[model samples]
Target: MIASSWLLVAFPALGALILLVGGRRTDAWGHLLGCATVIASFGYAVAMFVSSSLAEATDVALYSWIPVDALQVEFGLRIDPLSMTFVLLITGVGALIHVYSIGYMADDAGRRRFFGYLNLFVASMLVLVLGNSFVTLYLGWEGVGLASYLLIGWYTGRPSAATAAKKAFLMNRVGDVGLALAIFLMFSEIGSTSYAAVFAGIGDLSPAVITAIALLLLLGACGKSGQFPLQAWLPDAMEGPTPVSALIHAATMVTAGVYLVARAAPIYNLTETGRLLVTIVGAFTLLLGAIIGCAYDDIKKVLAYSTVSQIGYMMLAVGLGPFGYALGIMHLLTHGFFKAGLFLGAGSVMHGMNDEVDMRKFGGLYKRMPITFATFGLGYLALIGFPFLSGFYSKDAIIEAAFGSEGWQGWVFGGAAMLGAGITGFYMTRLVLMTFFGKERWRELKSADGREFHPHESPPVMTVPMIVLAVGSVGAGFFFALGDRLVEFLAPSVGALSEAEHTALPHALIPWLTVGLSLFGALVAWLIFGRRDVPVERPQNVSPVTRAARNDLYGNALNEALVATPGLWTTRFAVYLDNKGVDGAVNGLAAALGGSSGRLRRLQTGFVRSYALSMLGGSFLIVAALLMVRFS
Candidate 1:
């Protein structure tokens, strides 16, 4: 009966306020309050989705937020298919995380503050997705970044947490510069920042100007999405709680980039160069993250790398231009399910153990936590684009869209993504077998009984979400193919993307090829890492060349030399120049003038007799000179 549109955002924000103010005294109620709000929002999101699904285009404008003489910004809620889809994702998956956190953070001293931040993040993300215009969207953009900073540094005691938070904030600030400039450009050209107005103006702009604006927007997306040089922060961001990891990395924060690009599909379509840049960046990031993921031993760190890699896939779809939007969105939704499940399942394992995250320490956990193991196994399989799961449907579609292109670009991108998938399978298999199938590697680890809690299961709260997400991971893809109704509903909002076209391939070919590729990758992984005597450990005794990959190669070294070292040395050099060069010159000049004044002081001696003699001598000389002049 209630208006499901605004309620989706408003309730969570209200809950955040309650938790912020009263969480300290509420004990378990803090988490209860937070979880309740997300659940309520999720219900509203579902209602809104169902309602919008039936309607043409659902837009609810509250009032004009920012109005000038030339342009007006209306505060409104838009629940078209695109926003509805994301809204359901954010709230539905987000609620599960909130429930998971109640168990995950039960013993933490800052539990209240943690729930408060979590609720605030969800609220902000809703704002981001439901905004009717760019100005409204940016409020949520900045808000989520701020929440990420807070949650990433939740454990202020750890230096790594603080450092990661700083890196995220600063890197995002750099991207935001480009975003701000792009906004200004849009206003200058279109006279409005509304999605409707800017998109309409995009068709009229010169290709060169459109490319510039689109590239600037891409810069912002890259930072928010964690691509290329800006991606360093994501791996280190594991310093936060596991729920924080699930929420930020998997479900909410990182997906903002995909949303931005997809939303701006119209503007990006105006420039060919901009579209190509998107594809290139996406392909590179996908490979880069997968390669790095292969080297990590830490469970969460591997997942972190995997997140960066998966996001790269989404970016690649965006690069494919309007033709790739549905594929990108589909992948984004499936990704939320599987990735969040993976992070939560990992958290459950960590909970069972005494916060141990290294895969090297775990072995044969399948017998202990069957639900967690099963859910996570499905998640990994889904993420690797294994057939029948959600990721397979979405990933294959994108690749197919790539191959359906006019030139060799499709082959180039499809090949790269396929290779990345193979590596993805290899690492994930190593992760799974090492943690759940092998002999327990760490005998030093003992249970509370001083024996071993070798195969433990998480509580009901944690397992419930994992189960639900796992189901979603396996089933979400069908919604895209079967729900033309959904496509029609969202058509107007994302009308820009409908411009690009692709070769109509047999629908059967994509799933089959994706299944074949994924199976091949899995087989390779099984052959390499699934062996019983697999060298008794990982390939730690590799050649020097191979060792580089395991050590993150020279990535850290490059960062130090390129970014950190230069900044440090520049600061020291500037200090030296100030003290020894500029300051010294000023001091030297002052000393010389002082010394000259000291020498001149003798000429003004305080001797009355000497002063009178000099005066008489001067008078005699003057008279003699005057007489000579007169004679002449």
Candidate 2:
């Protein structure tokens, strides 16, 4: 199975091709087929992971992918600890999402086509994590981007969905440029893109070149992962179907950036500058997402921003280099379970409540939809680092790792991570309280869809997956963090963990401090939202801070001001130059020639009298010149 790991990608890719090509013919059972493909992939991944040697990487070369003069790249699979870990996550979580979508999307007219896109999404992500070379990874990278565009725009009739799809695609391209450049630099500097070769040859290059490569890779990571400025597209992506949000936010697209950074551990390990910049982006975006999440009435968008914030934690972890690489991957795994469950729970809520997403309108759901409430609540606990939950172990480890950093680096990054935890608790608690624990606001009136708000649980298909993920959310972190097993598992790929030589704070005290802050934040949320009768209508008048949080801290407006407006002016200027500089020169010369030729053309007017007069004048001039010469 390890030797034939290519089958993992093939199953889903083949399923996508069949479903897409079969078209309407597959409508009867296309979703089941999609689920089977991913489930098969997951089973195979589990087998390969269990069978394969964990100490060293295994290369399964398929064929020569690129055979240029100095560039010999093989299409191959790297069945290693790191890649296989992602493989299991993608296929396992992906398969569950597929099953959940069956119930989630059953009534939609485009269910068959949706299944096809889902298969494509799983296949592309498999290729991304399993690839042995940079070119192969890039192929998967672009495929994921394209598949996302298709999935996000599945509701083509909706103008908002189309706009969101375009936004995601275009914004991701900015980061793609960085990834492409990094690959080009790799090939130019090291003469190969194979992981083994690049890692081996990287040290031969200068520090400047290595740092450039690392930072460039980080830029691409930010794009795919929704860090910082690239973070805006993520929440807007919730305009797509809820299943798409769960898949993209939890198990697939957004996680790609964290995978990219973790995979490039060798490059990042050499450059403090690269790692420092990465940490800065992560710490800031974590807070930014948390802040924005607090003001959203929409449940899905709240989770979307939470995805942004959580990915920020992963980024912060991986940015710590050897000190936190395995910790990052651990958190990512645990986050996959809880976050995916949370999103699906949101979907279930929508399913029950006539497709409404506003938490302002959702209240006392726990009694109505016990299954969804139980699952979402557990997932929420995991997300907010509730004791004994998955997030508790993984997130606490990261905070401790942050505090281990020396000097101001420790406090700044540690402080950011700690503060982010508190904000995360506050906002997430606000979401849960408004959604499941408040007054029965939905009983007051009809929902947005003009239906009476009769909330119920999702069907067995969807609820089962939520339960499974919720289970993982509760316990996966303990298993992964136990004895540093995942760290040991990932050591061969990301390098062994290296503890900071010194610490700015007591290591044992850090977890206590983190839990204290998280609980305090939760307490504050209870005081503000839980103890009050929530209004159904959002308030117009608010404080500046509240307003700013509601507006995503003016991120979109800032983007318009800094990027869109300047880009628009630059484009207009280019058009103006093209019209005046290039076209004007060419057109002016053409006009000059046309004018000169018009005057000359006048002299050639066809007439017998004109020809005769010209001949007579010539004869007279010749005679006059001869006479004058003879006289002289």
Best by TM-score: 2
Displacement of residue 272 (Cα, Å) in model 1 is: 1.4
Put down candidate 1 lDDT per residue, 251-298, tens digits, no spaces: 799999889888888887778899888888888888888888877788
Off by over 4 Å in 2: 447-449, 498-505, 588-604, 615-632
**Stretches of model 1 off by over 4 angstroms after superposition:** 1-4, 53-75, 444-455, 483-486, 496-503, 534-539, 543-546, 573-632
Instruction: Summarize candidate 2's per-residue lDDT along 402-475 as a digit string, tens digits.
Output: 87776898889889999999999999999999999989998988865578888988899999999999999999
RMSD to the hidden true structure, all candidates? 3.9, 2.4
